[model samples]
Structures are given as structure tokens and as C-alpha cells.
Target: MQKLQFPAWLKAAYGRCPDAIPRGLQSETIAVEDACTRVTSEPVRACNAVPPWSVAARNGYAFRTEDTNPVPGSRPSKLNSDSDLLAPGRRIDDPRIEPLEPGTAIGMNAYGPLPVNADAVVPDDIATALDAIQYKRVLVRRLLPRGANVIQKASEYAAGDVLLQKGQRITPERQAVLIAAGVRELKVSKRPRIGVVVSSYERCAPLGSRSCWQTPDACGPYIRTLIEQWGFEVAQIEYISPPSRAGSTPQALHEAEISYRRRMIELAQRYDLIIGSGMLSTESHRRVGLNGLSWFAASSSNDEINISQGPGSRFNLAVSRDRSPPRTEKFEVKDATGRVRESHSIHHFDRATFVNLPGFLSSVTVLMHVLVRRIIDLYEFVETPGPCWEIGELARDVECDRKTNLMQWAKIVWGPRGEPLIDPLPDQEPHRVSAFLDADVIAAIPVCRGGLAAGSRIHFLRLDPMRQPAAPNCAIPQPIEIITEAHHSTEFESMQPQMNIAQSWSCLNAWLQSMPDAIPGGFRAAASDDDIHVLEAAISAKLPADFTASLKTHNGQVDQDGVCFEGESLLNIKGILSEWTCWRDVIANDEFEGITSDPDGGVKDDWYNLKWIPITRNGMGDSLCLDLDPAPGGTFGQVIRVWHDDERRERVAASFEAWLCRMVMDITGLEEQKEQKEQE
Candidate 1:
């Protein structure tokens, strides 16, 4: 029987399909600073020439090249050595502002602005070359060129020159050019999101059934790592170990097909590309059949390894938009010699492109390098499309016992001479998970040929998923606000010693004022400063900054549905005083065992001490309190929800400000904030 192959099948498919690859990628604006390794969607041109002026290239004295002629042997020019020629405050007036004629030496470096009249620059070492007499006179040893030691305007790039070209990655160097060009924004190819699935027909047999679904050691691990390193996102990639009778009964196969088809279409909806690996039914882990390809049971996916049409091809390129997948695809299976063995039809999506890799060693070997790599290249616009093979001599004897015509791949590794030495691994065999480990290079052994020697030269690409550029991570700067006069005045007024707490209730009132539809009327005004002062004196503890800040602005509750365990309202100043007394009466009899769980982990000490201030009622016979054990110079303000059992005290925030911010977010924002700042 003749050998079966993927490349040939792919070629046939390509001949039947359109030559043009379908549209897949889209363009988006990415901050120039956040664009390292990102491909340019369009050319990034400079708005203005770099430097904008001819400037000195080094630290030296600028002067007329004409006067420096025959320097060591000629009379010293009368160029004034007056360093005072520069303006005060480390600034140099543009030469246009103050002209300097020949013989006038201006001291400057690359960092300093160019003077309008100065031409060449003599290095500081010019002093060493000259005698003591010439040194004192600030003279040079030779005549310099017209633009010597000077960086001419636009020398790097002029206005409208491309700083970053389309299809190019913004590497560190390219990023620097954009920065120098003052291009803070640009367009980059959007990173494609991918999804991977490993479906097992046996999966129908209840989950965790004898671990038949054991994950492959080398399966999608390297693929995912490489894709992520290329800056593409992989939604998920998993391995499902072999087994099952999905092929036994037509009914079982039907069920499997239906189940897997639904799964594929669902994932296709969410990911740009889908690479699904099937189960390892055969011992060699290669022969793919209906059970293996059942994941896309309705699609045109045949259990054949055919990614060589690669990513730049029609199907792969469809990732940018929709692939317009056929709702169902028909497949006819042929024996090795070309006789039809079976015919089947499977469900496929109209938009998702799915690749099926059968459970075969040789198949994995061939597709892993060629196809997967092309996908990454197309996704990232990685300029280099591959077949970058390297030549190397075999260090050891190669075993060639096969008599079949099937072309296969064997894993190889490098030897001492920098040449990739073949460390031959088994091929086309069932489940050679061992080969999946400890190998890098691959060598193709032809039919009817056998080296069986130690010095035969073999070719392979030195491609290793580990060697690609790691994903680029650029940090974003948070916005910082500058304090305005209004802000300063507000702070000053709010902090006045004579001001009563009730007088500064604008903050809470203002917040309430803006939110009328808010859980109506549970909140009220704060107590007077004198009243709060009396409470503080009784507790002998200072309130946290955030707690006080909120009280000044929002000292009341409005939650009718209740924000806690029961329908308890947020406490106003008067409510707080009342809640404080009721809590005091209970704690007087039983020991305070309130141990609040810190959001950052561990227990907060003495959480329910009399020092804690009340914020709201729990209605479950407990109240929310603000712990205010001021740090020597700091104010205490951690929010804690407490219960009477002296148990289950949950610390909500580190400060009142944080607590208020969280509450505001809860009321207006969608999620609760739980920030754990990492220790430096």
C-alpha cells in the first residue's frame, strides 16, 4: 500500500480552494509605549525631523574648523575660552538669539543645544595633544570637516519618514525611534485570541472514569507557551487521554458526534482559531478516525494532519473576520493504497477554523513544527515565514528498519560542533509520549535510504518553542491629579479645628444629592463635632482618616433592602451612638472575642475593643465598626463586620477612605474591590 500524507492532501485542498487567503486580522490603536513586539498595522511616520537642529555630538568646545588648521604647529586662534558665553541656569540661548563669530569657542555636549554659528567640535583630548601654552589658549591640533562631530538636523529621519513600517514588530530599537519621533500613539495588529480543545469520546462515560482522560505530558504545553510568548492569547488547551467504544455502536458514535459537534461550534464562536487534539486510541497515537474528529462531527474536518497550507493561507487568514465555516462537511476515508474505506459527514461552524491533529506520532512531529509555527507567524505578523532548516552531521548511527513509503519525522538534537546532531526518536508509532520529551531537532529519512553511520549530514530547523521572544509587558502609568486652589481651600476648610463635624456634612449630602434614585432614605446627617469629640474622649481612640472623612460627607444609611445579613440601615451619628451603647452592654457581660479576618489573610487583633467605632447595624445582633488604633503618626481606620459570637469578624478595608471607596463602588460600580498590595 502507498503511504498516506498530509502535505499532498493539503495541496489538493488548496487547488480546489481560492488562492487568496481570507481576511482575518484587524487594526487597533496601541499606545506607542505599550507597543513593544506589536506589529504595525500601518506605517508610523515622523511628524518632524529628529534633533531639529545640528547639535554637538560630544562634550567639547565648538569653534570654526578654519581656525583649527595645523593646530599643533600653527599659532593659537584667539577664540575666547570664556565658558561664561553660555546663559545662567544651565541653559544655552539658541545661537540665533546670540551669535558667535569665528574664534569664539562655545563649550557644549550632545545634551546642549547647537549654536547658530559654530561649526566643528574638538574633543577635550585636544588639550592633551597641545602644549601647556596651547592648552591655556584653547586651541586644536587639526582642521575638522564642515559638519564634523555634529549631528545634522534630520540625519536620523526627516519629517514624513517612516519610523515604523507596516508588518514590522515594534522592538526596543523601533520603539526608541518612535519615541524620538514624538509618536506617542500608533496602530498595531490586534493580538488574535485562540481556543484549544481535547475531546474524548469516552468522555461520555462520566468524568474521572479511571483517569482515561489523563493529560498528555507534551501535548498542548509547548504549543500554548510558544503562542503566549508570541503575544497571542490561548483561551485554553487541554489533553484527553485515550479510550472508549464511541465507534462500536452507531448509536454511541451518533451521540459522540452530536456532543462533540456542539462543543466545537460553541468554542468557535469565541476564539479566533481553534486547534483541537483528539484522543490516543491507538498505541502509536497516530491513526486518526471518526471518534478522534468527532469534536467537529458536522464540519469538513477529516482526521488528517493538514496544517501545511499554513496560517497565511485562506482558512487561517479568516481569523480576522469570520471564516464563514460550512455548516457541515463531508469526508471520505481511503486505505493506504487508495481504496475507499468509509464515508462520513460532520457538523462544522460557518465562522471558526478548526484544525484536528490525530493521535499519531509522525503526524504530531510534522505538524508541530511547520503548521503551528506558521499560525503563530500569521497571528503575530512575525516577518519570518519558516523552512529555516539547518544542516548538521549525525553523531551516532541511525536505525532505518522501515519498509513503508510513508514520509515521517524523527526528533533530533545538536552535537558539539554547533551542527544539529540527530538524536533520533521513534516515529508513526502509537503513544510515544517518551519521544515528546528530551528532543529538539528533527531529521527526515527517505524511503530506500539508510545512513546507519555517524557522519552523514542531515538538515533541520533549529526551531525551539523555548527560544522565541518572551511576551512583551509594558507598564501603564496611572493618572495623577494636581491639587487645584479649589481643592486646597476645601481641604483647609474641612480641616479647621473650630469646624463642627455637622458643618462639614457637604460631602455625604452631595453624594446623596447626586443619587436620588439611590436606595431611598436610610441615610441621615452626622452628629456635631462636640458630640463626636465626646465619644472619642470616652473611647480614648482617634478615628481613622477615612472614617472621619465619610462621616463629614456621608454619615447616614439609605439601604431599605439592607446591605448586610438583615434589613439594617446604614447608621447616622445618632444611630452610631445608640448602636455603640447596645454593643457595650452585651460585651460588658461576655469577653470580647471579636477576631476579624484580615482580607489579606490572618486575624486582626482586638477587633471588637471599645476603641472600635460603629458604622451600621447588622440586624443579626451585631454592628459594623471602624477600628482606629492610630499608627504613631497615622490614623487607624480598618472596617470590620462583627457578630456577637466573638467569631467571624471580617476586616473589609485598611482605611476609612478605602472602605468608602469600596462602598461607592459597590453602590455604583459592578464589583467589590479587594486589593492586596504586595510587600516590596
Candidate 2:
């Protein structure tokens, strides 16, 4: 019944694995073009300097800087010119070309290496040619400063400079830089091989099969795909079917244990990591006679290590085999004197990391994202933690046992104040694989007594498949301050009844004018009564009093500033009407007729309700609307989100006035914070 905190468990888990790029992981030289996403095994240095010699940056005449006066309106500087002008592709060392003299100039094409002694170039537009009896003279009207219009030698990078450090992944941008630095090949770590093991008591069936009591392996293929996406190769996906007999006899259990151990040993010899999902509980381990296994015995107090996160609470981390002969590998390292020295690196291999995960699909997903992904990142030498975490406010109260950390799948919706609201999905019962279908992010709720209440700030990791690891400076968010409605009421009362919509509009407009950068495109002219009436007639919905007054003050933004609200553009009368008509058309066509709204929120059940009028857009086919027709137990005139691609509609505010009041308070509160910081 004892639980090991996640951080301590993670530390212990890391101790079992080898340092990054173990000796067993051999290095291979690959073409620079094929090095994207591969970690460098050794530091890569530039083979040659970029722009080996000074070159003209533009089509111009190259000449010495001292030969001409750089002041304006001065007599044109005269310089002797060769009969045959220098062109691109002509070698600067050609024997036919004379050395550039102080008073002589040479016509050179862009990117052409400068002739000897030429320090600057005059663009062709400012230089003219004059015919003379002895030789042609170039009369440059404007003088160019020294090194002007020239790309200096070794400006970008010098030969032997480190282009990429060890353990850095070659991104597309980095690859381009490496190619330009004359790096043709890179020594990168070989992809780590991973093995996925799914343990179950029931008979496994193929997906979509209707056979009796047969179910598909939910964690196998999904885990494989995740590992592959992270650039690791899944060598094999094997299933270990423990004896299904009730109250398994000791002999049967012993036989199952032998089979399981043999399979694990085989996988450990081949793979860098072994991920086992299902049958991680002590009872399950005992039933399979795996209680004697060293890896299973390392669990805290009990056979299972309870990580403070839910559905996936039961977990285990151990090294399958840690005793391996030290292997020595040679590496070319740069010495203090910048000379390459051959050094021997001693490391141990044959120690495959083993991670045991809970059986449920949701648990598998949570542990994979939070735990397994971290393991892969360490193995692959991923510098940044990847674009994983996003900040949002909890949409509603989430109750938990408070004994462990909770991992909840949530759908993201933008609030009226432009803050992201995390709406937890209903089907959190570990077995519901469908819970992940519509989930946008996985909210990591820290261990707390009464759980997190609505409007509490929390950070969650994104589940976006297309996201690439980036931003080395992205730090993991710290635990949030648990906020309950009762505790928040005091803070809310201090800012209430401050300003009405019309007054707030005036104050906001003044602030915007003071800070032009706040709204790049200024506010549009106020809407006329006729325009408002036209919009009402078009949408066939009456505009709320507060919304109508705000429109009269300013129709909308001139362009999408995304400043009116966090990342939304306030819609004008015409935009509102257009958006309404479009949604109405979608409804008439029955495009999403059977779809329903989120059951927990105060929004109506219909996917595209006719009574919802859009007031702002997030530029991603999602909008914040005024809900004139509210569902049962919902407030009329509430602000809600209507997503074009999702079926969730969430109520954000009680009314337009309430939303504007909060927006104003947020702006003013930020200003106050800034003022205090400046004073400090």
C-alpha cells in the first residue's frame, strides 16, 4: 500500500539505465542529407571556411577604399580598368589578371572572389565607364566604405570550428548549416532497437473481431507506433499469454514464469529497451509465478510502485540484465591544442531497460507519454523536452482520491478572456480506448486533497502527432496552486463592480492608443445603428444590450490583431452575419446532424445551434459565440465556444457583460503587475 513519489521513482528508474549512447550502440557515418533526426555520436567540425576569400556581395566594381573620397558630391574617383572585365567563375588567381593597384578597379560579378588588394566595391548603379586613349577609366560617383558590398572570408564560420556538438539531433535547419560548412558526412548513433511485450490473461484477437471473449491488443500497436515516431525501431511486438486457469496451480504458474523469463531474456539480448504492458500488478505477477524475478521484486514495499498519477498508477522500472563485460571503443576527440587524439571509451552493454505499465488502454497512453517518452528522449539524446506542455485552466471541478497523481485526458477550449480551458473527457475508466479519440491534451493533475476546482491553472502535455522536438529553453512547468471556488471567491470579490462594458471600453481604448504595439491594426470605426439592425435581421437573433453598446463603440479590429482577446479576432457586424449564415447553412445541410455537444458544459446539445451567434474567431475554424438559447441548467446570454472540427461546445461566461468585465480586469491586473515590477 506504500507509494513511491513520481520524482523518486523516476530517479531510481534512470539509475538502472546506461548513460546516453552506450558502447553497444555503434556509430555509423551517414550522408549529411540523410542525418535529419539522428543524434550525432561525436562533435562535427566545419571542414572548410565559408567564403574562403573575400567576395563581392553584389554586381559591382571592386577597388581599394583609400583610392576614392567617400563624401557626397565630391569629384568622381577615377580608376584604371582592364579591357576584359572580371566575371563570375573566373579564378581570382588567373595569371592573365593583374594584381589590383590602389588606383585601379576591376568590374566583378556578384559572388566573385575579389582580386588581390581590393578592399571595397562600388555598385554598378553608381559607377560609370569612360573611354580613354591609353585605357578605360571607371568613374565612381559615390564612394563605398571599406568592405562594403563584400562577404568577408571566414565570416560565417572558420575551418575546424564545431558545427554540431555531440548528442545534438540534426534538424533540417542544422543540416543545411552543416552542408554549407562543407560537412559531407556525419557520425550518428545507430537507432536504438525497442521491444514491446503485451501480457494478458484473455485470448488476444485481431482488431474488429467479434469472437467470444476475444479482445484486441490495445497497447501493442499503439506503443509500437509511438516508439517509431520517436525515431526508435521496434524490433518486435510479442505477446505473453499467462495461464488463464482460475486460481492457477503452482506448477502452472511456474511454467508460465519460465516462459515469460525466457522471452524477456531473448528480447533483452536484442533490444535496448523492453516495454511490457499489462499484468504489472502484484496479484497478476504472483498468478504468473514472476514474484521471484529480480525486476519485479524491486517494487516499493509492495510488488507494484504506485506512481502518483492515475489510471496508470501501477508501474515498475528495473534493468533486465546489468552484468556485462566492459567494452572499449575508440573515439577521435579534440585536445586542448585543437589536435585530434584517439581515445578509448569504456562502457557496458547488454543492460536492457525494462518498464512495466498497467494494462488499461488509458493507463498505457498516460505512462507512455509521461514515462516511456522520457526514456526515449534520454536514449536518443533529445536536447529539449519537446513541444509537450501547454498551459490551461481547468473547465470544471475534477475530484480524485488525492492519494496519487491523476492523468486526465481533456479537450481544449478557449475562454472569453482568451485563456485555454481544459475540459476533462468523461470516459476516464482505464479500459475506454475511445477516451483518447477526441482528446487534445493529457492533463497531469498533481496529488491534491480535494482535486482541482474550475478555473485552476494547470499545464498538460500535448498529444499532437506532428509536433517535432524543439525549443531547448522550454522548461517543464511547476506544480500549480490548487484553487477551489470558495478560496477564489475572496480574490474575485476584490475586482468586482469595477467597470461596466461602456466604461471599460473607453479605458481599454485609451490603453490601446497609448500602446500602439498592443493592437497593430487599429480599431475600426464604430458600427452604425443601421449596420447593427442589418446584422440582427441577417442572423435573426437579438443582440444583447452590452454587446450592442460595445459594437457601437468599435465595430471590430481593422485586421486580425489577436489582441482584443488572447488569440481571437473580434468580428464586426458583417463578419458575424457571414459566420452565422455559414453555420446555418451547415446545419441545414445536416453535415453534423447526429453530433452532440459536450454533456458536461452548459452549452446546448446540437452540434451547430442556430441560436448561437459568433462574436470572435480563433482563425482555426473555431469561434466564441453568444448563446441565446441555453440548455437546461444553463444561463441565457452565456458566452460559449463552437468548434468547427470538434463536437464540444463549452460555456465560458455568464454573459457578454461578465466576459468584458473579466477581460478588462485581466488587462488592468497585468498593467498593475508591470508597474510594480518596474518600481521594484
TM for every model, in the order presented, reads: 0.49, 0.55
lDDT per residue as tens, model 2, 1-680: 11212233245444433332343545799999888778888899998788667788998788888888655334567888874545434444532234586688987889877876788888765565556354478766554668989898889899999988887777678888999888999899776678888776542534544457657776888888887876667766777665455788989876866776677677777876778775645464643422224633223332345555567766665555443666666667888998987665655464666667765778888878866776665666554433345556788898766577677888988665555678888868777879888988887677678877987766677785335434212222454454432111223323443567888887667655544544457678889999999988877878888888889888988875343565577888878887888888888888876777663345667888888999898777899999888876566777887898776676677778777766665543433444458999
Query: Across residues 289-338, which tens digit of lDDT does each residue of candidate 1 receive?
Result: 22344344334433343332212121121222244644655679999999
Measured by TM-score, the strongest candidate is 2
Model 1 deviation from native, Cα RMSD in Å? 27.6
Residue 641 displacement in candidate 1 (angstroms):
78
Clashes of each: 30, 2
The worst-scoring run of ten residues by lDDT in candidate 1 lies at 485-494
Q: What is the lDDT of candidate 2?
A: 0.69
Residue 547 lDDT (model 1): 58
lDDT of each: 0.52, 0.69
Q: Output the TM-score of candidate 2.
A: 0.55
